[model samples]
Target: MPISSDHRQYWQTNLRYLAILLTVWFLVSFGCGILFVDALNHYRIGGAKLGFWFAQQGSIYVFVLLIFIYVYLMNRLDTKHGVNE
Candidate 1:
């Protein structure tokens, strides 16, 4: 069966959200943790180097936060698409 425009748009929006969230995760985990580690090291967080913190803990925290954000976003999207339980 053919897909309806609304369904296609819904999936597109979902993919866009996933792309954006994953990009953010990548930047935080790789950018701050590796690429900018030296620069970030200039700052301190909780007595630890900012970059080190990101590499060791910050990425995990951000990932968890992103999961929550994704859940909230998906809930809204589901409601908007009339697919919510």
Candidate 2:
């Protein structure tokens, strides 16, 4: 069976969301944690180096937050696409 235009658009939007979220995750986990570590290290968070924090804990926190954001976004997307339960 052929896919409808709505289905194609819905999947496209979903992929866009995934791409954006994953990019943010990568920037936080790898960019800040490694690439920009020296620059981020100049700052401090609760007495811990910002870069170190990102490398150790910040990425995990951001990932969890992103999960929640994704859930919320997908819920809205599902409703918009009439796919929600």
Candidate 3:
């Protein structure tokens, strides 16, 4: 099935957002959690290990947050572009 121009634009916008968000996600999760973890471990947060928390739990929470952010932004974009469904 062929998509209309409106749908194509909508999909393009969504893809752009997805790409940018995923890139940031990977940077935070892999870069901060694993690559820079040793440096981060030197700092402690509220008696908890910062690096360890980020590696084990923080990344997942951030990813979930990103999901919500994406949904909200997409909804706004859809409305702005008259693509709401």
Give the backbone clash total of model 2.
Answer: 0
Per-candidate TM equals 0.99, 0.98, 0.82
Error of 3 at 66 (Å): 0.3
With candidate 1 superimposed using the best TM-score fit, by how many Å does residue 15's alpha carbon deviate from the native? 0.2
Q: Write the per-residue lDDT of candidate 3 for residues 1-85, one digit (tens) a residue.
A: 9889888888898999999999989978998799989998999877767887888888898899999999999999889878689
lDDT of 2 by residue, 1-85 (tens): 9999999999999999999999999999999999999999999998999999999999999999999999999999999999999
Residue-level error in angstroms, candidate 1, position 4: 0.3
For residue 32, model 3's alpha carbon misses the true position, in angstroms, by: 1.4
Error of 2 at 64 (Å): 0.3
Give lDDT per model, in order. Answer: 0.99, 0.98, 0.88
Number of colliding residue pairs in each model: 0, 0, 0
Q: Which pairs of residues collide in model 3?
A: none
Name the best candidate (by lDDT): 1
Query: CA lDDT of 81 in candidate 2?
Result: 94
Residue 37, candidate 2: C-alpha displacement in angstroms: 0.2
In model 3, the Cα lDDT at residue 85 comes to 100
